[model samples]
Target: MTATPLIDPFQRTIDYLRVSVTDRCDFRCVYCMSENMTFLPKKELLTLEELDRMCSTFVGLGVKKLRITGGEPLVRRDIMTFFQRMSRHLDSGALRELTLTTNGSQLEKYADDLYAAGVRRINVSLDTLDDQKFADITRWGRLPQVMRGIDAAQKAGLRIKINAVALKGFNEDELFTMVDWCAERDMDLTFIEVMPMGDIGNENRLGQYWALSDLRDSLRERFTLTDLAERTGGPARYVRLEETGQKLGFITPLTHNFCESCNRVRLTCTGELYMCLGQEDMADLRKPLRDYPEDDRALENAIRAAIALKPKGHDFDYSRQKLDGQMPRHMSHTGG
Candidate 1:
């Protein structure tokens, strides 16, 4: 096999692609939706065939890692079929890692098939440990069931990772407790900085973008965090707590600009490829798919175009333009 040339906006070859299967989710998490948020029409979403073709083209273009995301990926009807087919493609070596990031509400029933299908890992978004708090934050708490999904994924032998967005008021109290939980089991606990992504001014207001560095500085006595080597996979910086052998990751997108080493491009649920979260500009991929029927040089060239256009980094992290009144499209939509 020949090497897929790496070419990113930062002069690095981009190899990561996050594909959003749908812009719809079952949960109405506070940060993700408004009291009156309307979902996208089914026809507006990328078809399974369109998605597979795009994934295959991008994989051929050197996207070694592909993450499936959704409003809730499993919320899509008959998602098992999608995974069964996608897994076969990923295993064929068009991609290196095929992973999914979900809310875990619907993973219990699908874990076995997903694992058997070739899905390599799972990242479950569970912010609060308290059931009521989880309910308050997610609106449809169902903490017990989500926990069940986590157990199911683990039992299925999926490389499970827990992603908790450490909101100052929501789950700030559980920061260390959560870390201890992951440390005890050696499961990776990732602290994702709440990003400004939507338009729900009141619900999505990022009033509490706490700095992880400060959180670490304050916890110097309890645990020592050692920085790990820089590698790009997800949007997090790696660090480990001393003596525990547990990985502690901080995705400080709001406070830190990690664009120099940025090597990712994203696909929206509607089949548009976004080069950066902050930029409104995107290449409308649905048109190309509608125009072309199969994976050809044109399709591969489009993937290359998207990769080559991958931004050096996002500038949205540091903009102080008062983010208390907006949320972009929700984490589920962008696969954050």
Candidate 2:
């Protein structure tokens, strides 16, 4: 039997859940994490079986869309096993969609398996197409390897979307180039504003910030953008390019917030439920999951309790050249 749908205090039905399978990644993007960082110990992470149970519980509570994220989800050991396990929910019609966000580093090895497991679309974090700039942006990423992975994923018939972080003075020159490239390859693109998170100093955060409004104005010089009244269950707002007929998305957390229509929550690999991305409030679900291993009643109650405390909106601000409402946790910690 399906449990009652999870709803927040503002009467928003929580139907989407983003699960972090691991806290480790192969690349350390400049805006995402520090060059030299320490990752979580494997012992602290929830086992694959435990993750399956937790996600299944969410499905039972009417979570229609599930997105598996990570520092890089594909890099986790035996990660496809988790995708394969979750496919059961998709097959049973309890879950509407099952997808993931990756860095495109491991897609070459797992692309076929991901398609087999019911992932029709995926988001790949690619900041720059220039090899040298790509290397600089992702401290440890090789542009050629990522390109090969993208090729493999395309060959495996997975719909790809490129997610780029808009950094001032970094990829401003390649804005048009990126749009043309995605149009040629039949892939959608989204530009995200860098959020104030992790070990970033105020000076660095201020330096890297790029407003999407400025970006939109730049594109208007060369293209016609038509606003689309559709959302993909995430924070991105879409606009269709009249010339290319391809969709472009913008995630502007600083200039404009999308928390009013928020219907999602993030779950860390350690069973921590983060109600909002820009806020520090979270609930530890690990204890309840382990304590009531045989019965899911306590676990469900805990999830309900957490949802009841969900805030109406986040307070991420970058006004007057000051960084405010910055979270201490790294983006990778909660699976950006």
Predicted model with the maximum lDDT: 2
Q: How many residue pairs clash in each candidate?
A: 10, 0
Prediction 2 TM-score vs. true: 0.98
Give one digit per residue, the lDDT tens place, for model 1 in 1-336.
235675875687678888888777778787766646677888888788778777777776677888888778888877677777777656677678888889999888899888898886888888888889888888865899998998888888888788887677777778778878777655788887777777665753456576777667766768777899965476788887787878877888767777677677778888888877656557878877877785356666666677666656555643565753233556555666
lDDT of residue 75 for candidate 2: 87
Clashing pairs in 2: none
Off by over 4 Å in 1: 1-6, 230-232, 317-321, 324-328
Count backbone clashes in candidate 1. Answer: 10
Instruction: Give lDDT tens digits, candidate 2, residues 1-336.
Output: 347899999999999999999988999887887887888888889999999999999999999999999989988899899999999999999999999999999999999999999999999999899999999889899999999999999999999999999999899999999999999999999999999988844338888888999999999999999999989999999999998898999999999999999999999999999999999999999999999899888889999999999999989999967778988889999998
The number of the candidate with the highest TM-score is: 2
Q: Can you give the lDDT of residue 291 in candidate 1? A: 79
Q: How far is 94's C-alpha from truth in model 1 (Å)?
A: 2.7
Q: Could you list the CA RMSD of all candidates, in the order they appear? A: 2.3, 1.0
